[model samples]
Target chain A: MICVENISKSFNGRAVLRDVSLEMQEGETLAIIGRSGSGKSVLMKHAIGLLQPDKGRVLVDGIDIGRISYRELRTVRRQFGVLFQGGALFDSMSAFDNVAFPIRTFTDSTEQQVRDRVLRCLDLVNLSDVGTKRPSELSGGMIKRVALARAVALEPRYILYDEPTSGLDPHTSTTINNLIKGLADQLDVTSGER
Target chain B: MAALEQRLIRPLYSLGRYALLLSKGFTSLGHFSVYRKNLIVQCGRVGIDSIPIVALAAAFSGAVTTVQTAYQLVSPFIPPSVIGAVVVPSLILELGAIVTGFILAGRVGARIAAELGTMRVTEQIDALEAMGLNSIGYLIVPRIMAGIIMFPVLYVTAVLVGVGGGLAAAVATDVVSTGEFIRGARENYLVFGPMFGLIKSFVFGFVITSISCYMGYYTEGGAEGVGRSTTQAAVISCVYILLSDLVLALVLL
Candidate 1:
């Protein structure tokens, strides 16, 4: 579970999020609906401890993220999978390697195991055939799908999607929505969408 | 009062941020096993990839220095071998490292800044952090290690190529015979010459890598910001390299 309490954030003394509070329980899909520049992404960043609030605290699994050491914060962060607005794929790596990255980093899986898991994640996102493509070569929709594949590669407890379907075509957006729903049900994962 | 505080505070804030970034690069060194692979890849980037340019620059510098020195020593009493003496020490003690430092300040430093700045703007760095990875350990550490390791190797290469170029130019220009040049170099060669150059290269390596990494990592805005960081990285690396060169010469020599 993630709990944000009275969080306030500002940039250059201009307030973005003020007195915001929320809670997300396990196995739930929560959507933060707001227009662009409405701090939806900022709020999501706070929930994952990516940005600390100027005031108030974030609690992950009952431990206050603001009060913990970085090592402890990383331990908390491991429970999350974030799909950033830009897809945030490593430009140097292929789609397959990008998906395999988290798995290989956190697990002592053999090469074969890593490959199998990466392919499965790609399959889940319907990007099984584009694994060898770099992010630069992929279309916007394909990039988002590959990023989604990478996000769920570790089967994280909570997956955060920031404007995942924004700017995508209606067909692609529906495909993404369905994939998100299917992955949530299949993996039994909590989800937060902005 | 407010304006004055802002004027005084901004540079200090940047300094503090730079120092803190360096501290993070050192402090949060994650698994060495992970670093080993990255370090090797970076070595190839900073070392093996840089040889041609360094060699090219060193050769011209040495040839020019030899020709110029030969021109200046127009006296019956001065042996032609004196050109070798002057050229050898100049290349080994100063030109080799300084030239390489300047070249890399533009080449490697700007490249690091652009790469990291792009990552910053693209949210790739945040993505790495979000994944519970030590982004510093993953990105900066290997680059820094490569810089420190490769700079001196390039310096040695520069010194060797520089001396060879000097000898070649001396013979080709009929300024000094090959044997005379070798004799002069052997006679005037000091144990401290190459040592000082090596030391300078190491310091320059750290300056270029750390400053550029700091500039790149903290970059804000977008494409314009990336261009700004890349330019700053190159400019600042060059400035710091020269400044440190003076300090090292004073302290070490």
Candidate 2:
């Protein structure tokens, strides 16, 4: 479970999050709905240990994320996956390499194992045939799915989606929403919490 | 009275921030290899691409040094051999260090600042941070490592090019025989002097890389910000390299 306790973040003396507190249990799909500049991204960043609160703490599975060292933070980060709004794919790498990045960086998997795992993740996102394409060549929905595949490449216990359906058509958005629902259900079955 | 306090306190706060940044940069060295591939790319861009200009500058500097020394040696009390001695020491101590540093400021320093400043503006650095990676380790450490390794190698190349230019000037003017000039150069080849040049190059590399990275990292705005950062990196690296060279010469010489 991830718990945020009275988290307050300010920039240049202006408060963005004012004593915000929340808890996310295992296997739960909690959609953060807010208008523009509603601090939705900041809240997500804080929850995932990407940003620190000025006046509170964020605990990921009983570990205080903000105060831990970077080395320890990596371990915590390994349990969570983030699909950025912009995809954030390394432009220099192919889709296959992009999906395999986290596995290569954090795991001791052999090259063949990494390749097989990346292919499996790509298959889950229904992008099995686009592994050789760059992010620039993909359509909006395709890029998002590739990014999602990269995010879940490590088989993370938790996943954070930032405007995953923001730029797509309604039909594509529904497809993405269905994928999110399915993944959340899988998490529930595996973790027995959420 | 309150305004005076604010003025003094603001600079103190800036200084504190600079100190904190330096400490963070030093601590980040252990994770330098994370960006090794990027560093290799950057080194090729900065060092190898700029070799033609560096060689041109070194050649002209060598010719000018030869001319000046030859003119000054016309005194009855001064032997012509003293010209090589004077040029050798000056080249190793001042010309070698300062010229190479200036070249790097124009080439490598500006490139680093502009590239990183673009990355900063484009939110790439923020993306790396959001992934729980240390930005310093992911970006600056590799550049620093590359600068330190490559600067000395470039300085040696500069020395060879400069000497070849001096030989060319000598042949053109017939001021000294080729054999005589070569003999004089061989006699004045002090190992310690070139060692000083090597040390200066290393120090200059640190200055260039640190100042460029700092300017790039703190850049704001957009294209204009990147341009300003590049200019600042080049200017600050050149100034710091010259100042550090003087200090090292005083201590080592």
Candidate 3:
């Protein structure tokens, strides 16, 4: 479970998040919907320990994220995966390498194991054939799918999706939403609660 | 009154902001290992990768130094051997440090700033932060580390190639015997010359990396902003390196 308490954040003395709070229980999905610049992403960033609040706390599984040491933060970070708004894949690496990046960085997986896991994630996203392509070569939809595959690569207990369907067609958006719902159902992953 | 206040206060505010950013960059170096692999990649890209160009520049500069020095000392009283002594010290002190620094500013510094600036414009840095990664640790540390390590190596390579080219020029022009040139170089008070060059390289590396990273990390706007950052990285790093070289020479040399 994750809980955020009275988070307040300001940039250049202008408040972006003012006394925002939220909570998510195990196996629950939460959608953070708001207008542009309504502090949705700021709230999510605070929850994930990316930004420390001025006068609040974020507790992940009873541990205050702001109070944790950096070494401990790595452990906290490994527990969740975030699909960025624009699919921040490394431009120089192929999709397969991009998917395998986190596993290679944070785990002791062998090359074969990394490859197998990457292929499995790609298959899950129905992007098996596109593994060798760079992000520039992929369509907008394919890039998002690749980003989703990379986000879920670590089998994270929680996944955060920011504007996941912002640029996709209705059909593709439905497909992604269904995929997220299916992944949550099958893997027992928690998402943002509404 | 308002115009005067704006002129003074705004500039002061900018200066203060720059100081704050410099402090932040210094603090960020503590977690450098988080981006160790990336540093190695940048070192390969910036240092080892720019070897051929640095060598070519050094070689030509060395040949030019030999020719100019020999021409100026056309008097028969001053042996042509003195050219090696003059060239080696000058190369190690000024050309070796400043030229190599400028080359790196143009090559690696601009590239890093542009790459990170693009990432900034594209929101990748924000994405990393949102993923619970320290943007400083993930991005800046590796680059600084690579710069520090490779700059000295590049400096030494420059010195060797430059001196070798100068010697070849001396022999080819029949201005000085090979033995005379080598002996003159050996007798010179440059026992600590390479050490001085390395020290300069270290300072140059820090200046180039910090300035370039600062420009890139704080870039705004879009593609034009990125281009501006790249230009700023190259220009600012070169100017800082040169100014610091003078300061270091007064203090250390």
What ranges in model 1 sit over 4 Å off? B1-3
Per-residue lDDT of B103 in model 3: 95
Residue ranges of candidate 2 with Cα displaced over 4 Å: A129-142, A168-172, A186-194, B1-46, B68-83, B187-189
Fnat for every candidate? 0.73, 0.22, 0.39
Using lDDT as the measure, name the better of candidate 2 and candidate 3: 3
Q: DockQ scores for all the models shown?
A: 0.83, 0.32, 0.37
**Alpha-carbon local distance difference test for all models:** 0.92, 0.79, 0.83
Q: Over the stretch B51-161, how does candidate 1's per-residue lDDT look in tens digits?
A: 999999999999999999999994689998899899999999999999999999999999999999999999999999999988887899899889999999999999999
Task: Report how closely model 3 matches the true complex, as a DockQ value.
Answer: 0.37
DockQ result, candidate 1: 0.83
Model 3, span A103-182: residue lDDT tens: 88767888999999999999999999998999899988888889889889889899888888888999999988988898
Write one digit per residue (lDDT tens) for candidate 3, span B127-198.
Answer: 565545667666776787788889898898888889988888888888888888887787795767778888
Name the docking class for model 2. acceptable
Estimate, for each residue in B1-253, the C-alpha lDDT of model 2 and write its tens digit.
Answer: 9899999998688567656666675675444345767789767766677678878888888888988888867467865666566666667766866888999997899988987887777555655665556777767877877788888878887888887787787768766667767777768778788889999989998889878988898789999999999999999888888789779978998
Cα lDDT tens digits, model 2, A52-87, are: 889999998899998888767866776877887767
Global CA lDDT computed for model 1: 0.92
